[model samples]
Target: MQEQANLNRRNFIRISALTGGGLVLGFNYFLTSCSTSQDGGQVIELNAFVKIDTKGRVTIMSPNPEVGQGVKTSLPMLVAEELDVDWKEIKIEQAGLDTVNYKRQVAGGSGSVRESWESFRKVGATARQMLISAAAAAWGVPAAECATENGHVVYKGKKKTYGELVEQAAKLPVPENVAVKPATAFRIIGQRTRNVDNHAIVTGQYKYGIDTKREGMLYATIIRPPAFGMTLESLDDAEAKRSPGVQQVLRFDNKIAVLGRSTWEVMQAAKKVKPQWKEDGTLESTADYTEKLHGILAKKPEDKPRRQDGNIGQAFAKAAKVIELAFDAPFLAHNTMEPMNFFAHVTADGAELYGPIQTPERARGRIAELLKLPEEKISVMMTRMGGGFGRRLMTDFVEEAAMVSRLAGNVPVNVIWSREDDMTGGFYRPMCSYRYKAALNGNNELVAWHHHSAGVSGGGASPDSFPAGAVPNFQVDAHTYKSPVTTAPWRGPTHNYIAFSEQSFLDEIARQAGKDPVALRLELLEQARANPVGKVNYEPDRFAAVIKKAAEIGGWGKSKGENIFQGFAAHFSFASYVAQVAEVEKQADGKLKLKKIYCVVDCGTVVNPSGAETQVEGSIIDGIGHAMYAELTLTNGRPDQSNFHNYRMIRMREAPAVEIHFIQSSVAPTGLGEPCLPPAGAALANAVFAASGVRLLDQPFIKSGLFA
Candidate 1:
């Protein structure tokens, strides 16, 4: 039955001729990420990848936001791959936010490249097929006899530029099925091609959302409540209105917006507009959250188990020894290099929005609903983001821009959040803590595993990760607190804290069992592949392969320089397996210095090796920075750190050298933007323990006086 359905499947390709000279090819594209409209509905978006000009130039339109994940450069390679064109011969453009033409253009979860792999290949292949048919019809030969090579359709001793045949090809009937090239035929792909916008970016010619400008546009800055759980009581904007360059001051919800001629003027004036506020909810602090998290796990309640295997009580009763440990991680701020900013011109007729938003479709839909206008009346465009890092996923800033524009006489407004406003704003990574109790038998083998994870404002840890199926008696329980604070997904949302806590716990368990951590992990992976167990989320062999590769490349357990120690950790997240080995050098004054980080990734086939390496290196550096010195704390419902001065980021002199390796596979690519990030902390924490001989259970090792 499946075979019959496969035989009946057909691709609908829509091809048309350009007005003067050339061809345009579009096809149905559905993102598998479940990315949806403002009403939570997914739509079929048409992707137009190929557009040929009279000069024989092929323009490939990338339909996703570029958030430094290399989607702008990588996604277009898929189209160029099947079109049989060299990388330098094609042009790339960032597609505007038009839901009628693009779907699921969100950049979160690293879904851009993976979701477009097959569909985009079909796009180029379909166009190639149509071009081949046109060439065959003109030459009076079989369509199969004509082949495309380097932007030209060729027959026996005869060839024609794609530009010459596109007009006739546009008139040909769309083919139901087209063949894509095999991995071996790849020319543009697997080549370490530089980012298409590298020159523009380095030359400062690239325009970000913060750089947006329009005629009659007014610069605006929001003055939100100083603290969470607060409400506006009174507003006094007389002074702000009289200030230099200050145009108007408007109040909306619990915040105030100050408009002026420039960002500098508006920012200076916003400070003068004072507003009285009252507490709407309990003012919570980080100390309170930490105490609650640590205190709750004493009971280790299993009321709602996410996954359960054999009888844990019986296994613990029969075990030789039980190891119990607890781990905690602090809340993290996204802190995107470019602060949240959006440009919106809201009039009674229509709305225009442009910004560095990660979720453009959602922004458009939201603006349409907010303004009581039809979706077609609103237009949202995406500019190159300085950095997304999951901060732009939320549409709060986008909504603010639109609302400010609407309330201010439906004028043009460019709402920008200052760095301090961005840091103090909500939607941060939730604070998380974990408790693990594992029972080991006489043979130093894991018998039972019980883990309970707690988080503020809900989830940051996964209950269905590794070691679930590798053990006989395993159970995962979780508890979440409903706090007034807002929490959102940050990078590998589920695995971010889970991997660190769980992997570190696993390392501790191995040490307690007098076994090598890597060897024990392999043993469990082998059991996962061979023995009876509960549900497993990762492929055992693939997971094991990365670990082995990291060990080989990093020289795990090998000799190193004086005062140098190594740590190992592996995790699977976003459908990718990653293993990292961190090397640390212990200073004479009981400090830890990063020596290097070795990362091995099994994200299937890498689309762009250069970009892929940058992602891995970035994740390592980011994870290391956070683990070493970065921390975000709250005091009486207010963030303690406002900017880089107070919030300690890793410095350039402290940046460690990194080595990255990827497993070569013919499978479709999985997530790469975030998978490598989760394991960095895990490996770093373990390496800290190895170097300092201290079992670190909490994050921000620098604050713990372990790292300088």
Candidate 2:
């Protein structure tokens, strides 16, 4: 019933005239359809998303959180484009959590532009139509005679600004249906535009969640258990409380918190308090886990079949040659730059929380339940995030802050996690192992393929990955091992490891068949396009488009000045297709050096070309960094690496030169955040093989001894 009410409210728009003659147009989530103002009634909803002042300044609310993905700027560009207003005259405002007015306020899945493209444009076009109608009616002319251009209604030789017509426009009824501009008529979109918050970001004026400040706010640091599945047996905070600047030390369910007047004092005092914990002894060491994974793969366990087609046993029996290989990837941490921090002020009536959360609505509900308060009384505000990737999707940090505040006499408290705390935290990407087997006929034609993956619980391979529909007899099976460590989505999720294994295996298959890598993929794509097996999720033609474009632009087979070798790989994810080619060279000290990378993407209509390009570039660099050096090992069920010094990142000197190209099409836009990341690790591995005769079957290629 509540869902129906929200859906019904989305159909109508309300225009309220302010005392200064300003016009505020927004979605109406309450009140009846009548426009008449009643006695002392609040006709306008508080969730006004758009406002046009008498000075001709337009303000558009950004409904989603800005986690350095450029949604704050790109979303408003969509509104300004259809509103027929100059981008310079518009201001962007970050919106608070209001599910009734704004729908799906999220930043993950890269769906910001793809999902909100049509609805935001409709809102802008409707406002423009109402203003034009008012101008035409005042001039005693038909509405069709007046058209909006740049912020004015022009008919014949006379023109009036939108400010002049807003007063009368607010009194007019909204049109049911308004015409939106076509793709060809787009002027502000598809153009390179700077970020709206770039100046504030570079000037150190942008306020991130970690930079949030409030009156009488206290700082807190948590001392968590050393290992997974551990229980706090005893905590000694007598010395911690007596330390300088320390106010109090509180014990929670699984951790102890030290609250103080300053962050440094809390951090310093937190280390002095010693906590003893008892482990459940359910977690295995890293070496034991690796051996257990191999054992699981060797045994014929009960198969959880994801996809199966044709007779795989018969095809393998008739094969002339067969190839089998196994691959593994370690657990990974998000390690966001800002760490995890949230401010909470819980009162007797309600609770207020502020932080850089990816899902504000979900957080609000969870906090409300935790505080034992009504959902309507709780509020969650989103702040700019230093980085989210996929860490902010979890609300554990938010819940901790609220719990701390509630336990501390409902005083405002801000909980902050240090770099070490975040690194040793739970919710890392699950470790995975993949085993693959392939058979070929006498004519060197692929006949059958089998894939089986084993991983920690909640991690599995994509059944619809490449070679699924391309092979005659294909099957994918999965097995899971239960453990106490928590795991969640990290960027591309399962596709990240799946692409590395599948693409690299394809390159090896091409070499064994005495065929070019790119040619072999194209042939398989052609086969899938000609006679696709059961429901193929990807468009074969679009998949082949990026492959051909990348090869053409990258000069696939061309020489790259001596010692430089190139490699190519492609994959499709998040409804977008991307292909990448990497170039590498061997250094004198027996080390591999990345030179350059060429990429081709087909994500449908480009909203902001500049921002899209940055996403692709960043993904490539991030993928390379993880493939080269990022890995989290375990000892006694605890993370071995803590800070950046041990879990190194790729520096600027090690970053490769990147060149990107996008396919031109009129289709709807898809996400760019994760689609370009899957193939980068495989592409770099393939390039290393070309430069030096080594086949890397595992990740963290630097430790695989390719250079040694």
For candidate 2, give the lDDT of residue 5.
26
Can you write out model 2's per-residue Cα lDDT over 470-531, one digit (the tens) per residue? 88898888877787777878888788778888998899888888889999999888878897
Candidate 1: which stretches are off by over 4 Å? Answer: 1-20, 31-47, 300-302
TM-score of 1: 0.95
lDDT of 1 by residue, 460-504 (tens): 546668987899999888888788788888877878778888899
Q: What is the C-alpha lDDT of each candidate?
A: 0.84, 0.83
Give TM-scores for every candidate, taking all chains together and pairing residue i with residue i: 0.95, 0.95
Runs in model 2 deviating more than 4 A are: 1-10, 13-20, 27-48
The 10-residue segment of model 2 with minimum total lDDT is: 31-40
Q: Whole-model lDDT for model 2 versus the true structure? A: 0.83
